[model samples]
Target: MATAPVAEAVSLDHRLGDVVVRLEFADDGPVRLVGLVSADAFDASRPPRPRVTPLVELSFAGESHVRHSHGTRHRNYAATSRLRLVERVADARRLSVTQRDPETGLVVVTTIESTTPTTVAIASHVTNEGAGPVAVEYLSSLVLGGFAEAVEADVFRRLRVHTCLMAWTAEYRWRDESLADVGLVDAGIPHPTSSTRTSYSFGALGSWSTGTHFPQGAVQDRESRQLWMWQLEHNGPWNAELDDVGRDVALSLSGPTFRQHHWSQQLLPGESFSSVRAVVAPVVGDVDDGIAALTGHRRAARAAGAVELPVIANDYMNCLMGDPSTEALLPIIERAAAVGARIFVVDAGWYADDAGWWSTVGEWRESRARFPNGLVEVTRRIRDLGMIPGLWLEPEVMGVDSSALGDLPDEAFFRRAGRPVAEQGRYHLDFRHPAVRSRLDAVVDRLVAEHGIGYFKLDYNVNIGEGTDVDASSLGAGLIGHERAYLAWLEAVRERHPGLLLENCASGGMRADPAQLGVTDLQSTSDQEDPVLNAMIACAAPSVIVPEQAAVWSYPQPHYSDDLNDFTMIQSVLTRVHLGGRLDLLSPAQLARVKAALSVHASLESFIPAAVPFWPLGLPGWQDEWLALGLRSGQRSVVAVFRRGGTATVLLPLEGRATILHPIDRGARVSEEPNGLAVTVPATPGAVVLDLIG
Candidate 1:
């Protein structure tokens, strides 16, 4: 492979046990990039899949699989990568490359989207041929340069790629791998793969083999720096494929020279195989951070191109009461001015999407029965109160009642005409069409100009569907075209509402990838209602994102239950306190308590969001009765702690004397140490404070 002559380029270094970045630009255009995966990363035990075989003439193990369209194999290859590239040929500025896996027969596809000469967008898809009953897994080792230091390497700036989280089809929460109907376990985050430094593993998902291994010393492309490994298993799956979404994206990557694993979902003969598109551009920082910086670069590019935006919010799956009535929002809007909450969000209900709010999205209408006066009145109330009203929208899907039903082409969907496509909640939108793009733009424009929605909560939690949803005749046409459509939509909206705040969701966390980082201002942690879960998320969130963007919401109750306690309630709103819990539907006294809690949070949040340089103050969360986040801004520091009681003696990590707040009574006391002060919590109460040290 010929290496491009190097000019000033992005570089990497390490900080706080992680990687840091320094991106320098190429003089003329993006630096040409490619992958050099070490053969050592591949197990000597497994065989590699075939390569660069033309998609039109696939001869898998000499067993020819004919391309079928309209119930006929009109051509030897109906949908191939060669055809996929044609979709994006017109947009040369967009990333235009794809590749395949050498082992595991998993089809690997990618696309490079460069918003700037220095920044590039990388999108990858990995699938299998549903060949032999095989288990497929993925592991991409992004080797850094020789000038990089490994000790200080850290992953910074992660954004949500997919943000929509759906309540399970049957389970109230998530399953270990798939959905299970009968269990109280929301299993909010199922462990798909156990974390290991050397080898990452994952459980079986919809179609592929489940885990990946991380080799500790596989940072190739350098002769100096030693490498470390961070193995990961798939958390679960979030498919955006509607019928053939995966196939469409795959066909666009290149020809069918991929490693694949085949399996039967049931005892029946079921297979899962895919193709991919790709491009590798030299980027800065650790791999994750590089992705974030590039995403920011792209958003900036579009902003420079004139994308108009207004900030907004929407109450979604967690805070929903299943009604979109104006009255449902009275309390939230009522408090807007006081807390300076700029936007009042009403999720799901306002639009007459399907028979209910959860399915059949994209229809735009006011449910008169739900909102008696109309959304116009609701917006008036919000504006009158000096806040903007935002609506939650799932433009990527259509329900059974969608007007576009049976009216659109088959190429827009993932399933074959009669094949079993994963149609769990609704029909996934085919963003591959310009017509669809225009309709969506119109929807946003009308909503913003007329009803006055300042924000859009775009949630896409389910997995991408297969590309077979469209007619077999138009196979693969949706490939790269689909990506262009999505980017165009975002670019247009930014040009339209350059400052509009968009909250992205993909089943909550699945969509938070680097490509969409700064494109979205606020991001969620997870759709967790439990403080235990919230505490768990808190431990990890500061490592990647700013606190303000985390979904650190806690209610006075268990979100769905009335079992409330002062300790439990405080536990709920500690991070990003929305003080939300069916607010319009809360008891009078309970509502009062919520306001009180918010008041306390108001004081603490300033510290929480700005309290950088945090350290775990004596392993606080391990106490089933306690939860805390400790921070240091300079020499001055404070630790927010709440105890569930039981003569607990918590260790203080601070060396200097500090003052502490007695969680109860909002009282304060100075510590008596040799130097100044260091405090501890009283047995049954909690504490918040101003800690000072010399």
Candidate 2:
């Protein structure tokens, strides 16, 4: 008699805050993160899946997997399929699951921590305990299956993905596409299969974590109005993909892969490697709900010193343009203090003489030629004007002609094939090296102690292609190591100087990810100089970043009209304003207008930290005529609208008594309706912000 043994299946339903996760285990297979839902939608009595896959995908030596160029799953490996659950631990706020492969002695542990009621941060680590080494090609930080199980309809047609198109100067542009449109369709008709050949993926390729695309994505269920948003918290190359798994969809978020980033890791005995962190937020409503939950988590993750959200004035955007001299900065500092700016930052070109500063920037010495009495003269003046002094430092790069290059050894910089990796006349520093970190720490300490500097603008302008291949592993793996070391250095710096504020700028937000934003104080939204283009970026900034952390430029030129002044002023009134431009050259009327805008910003700054952003006109497009961003906290709401070149009138879905906050005499009118507000601007290129109380 022949008998078929029943499949061994087990499931654990864990709840953390308002979110629920279902962990599936099988005797013949690995444990899997099969389900994620809000507490309200979870049912404890539901049966578990008979078959399960690995929660952590590890592509190692002597293994083969079914994978496409864009996906990260469908691997048929005995190492993963035979893995057995070793331990499970949980609490009210966190959960940990551990599994091991007995044959190879490879262990994987996944930890999920609750950041908000609906947001959870997930990360994994792999340990090699075998006698021999294991070469890993691809490892996932987060892998979630059955993503579309809650939707009873056709998952492909009812699901939509929103991707952020990020680049230099053009950042945070969102594009929405259907799952079917991206080729993740149902291929099985009469006979169903779990394998699919297509996947929709987007990721960054180099040191610029947000260069080509932001490490952020969102999936929306059009039928049930469910939304799932996630961001991979890595400062270097990363990838995110969505593909079909049987009747459901799956998501894979990871730092680097052999296929994508040329990343591979050789793990020796008793060695462990940790993957990057990723946060997932589940909501039962639209995009706003997802953003609100993520925003709450981000605020809680910020450093203690960044709670104030102070106004900062930098002289690099459209005013001085990186040429900072004592004579040129004293007047600007006076005007900035007059306009109520809390911090004055001397941006770039402060460390070099008139000969040129790009190829000799690593020394970070105050140029006596630019400031005859040394930088102390300018910094002291900034302090005398009632503003905290700040300076820009690119700590991760060394100029080819830098004097420090001769003092530091070859191991201190990034190397490939026995030579230092150079890009744009600069050599990238390998933060993994202790010597590199020490040099940076000494530079920071010297500047802070000598110049009374309270703020540092950490700008990274160069992107070294693959990464360093100096010590061990592949180029991408080396990059991951350096990124982790860089974060550690940043944390150490913050600990040493508790009151210091660090602004993250990578040629203007090329490295603006949660990994950086979670540690830094503020992020520059863009380097876009055109006021019109900057307005569109300001409107969409809150979708990808928290409103308080998004530093939008409000640099108004002296020759601009009154309407144009309002337009530029409104660009940053709601976010952290990075004031620049020739304020010292403005006429009395223009200066008065600038002062009035700053007064409004000061009054509303308290609400900026706690407020969650929404768009009454939906997300703005690149060339959209009208753009709007709304921030709501408590019972009060603030809406900033701009008319680039469209009709003068646009209706917003809001209900309240509205009062103009800026440009009080402008021809803009706000008429309250039963459930909406009818807003009108008398002219194009006009902007306005109104306070609403219901």
RMSD of each: 13.2, 3.4
Off by over 4 Å in 1: 1-320, 336-340, 353-355, 404-407, 417-422, 465-488, 557-577, 584-626, 631-638, 642-647, 656-694
Best by TM-score: 2
Clashes of each: 104, 0
Worst 10 residues of 1 by lDDT: 241-250
Off by over 4 Å in 2: 1-7, 45-53, 66-78, 189-193, 303-306
Give the per-residue lDDT digits (tens) of candidate 1, residues 353-374. Answer: 3346565455677778767777
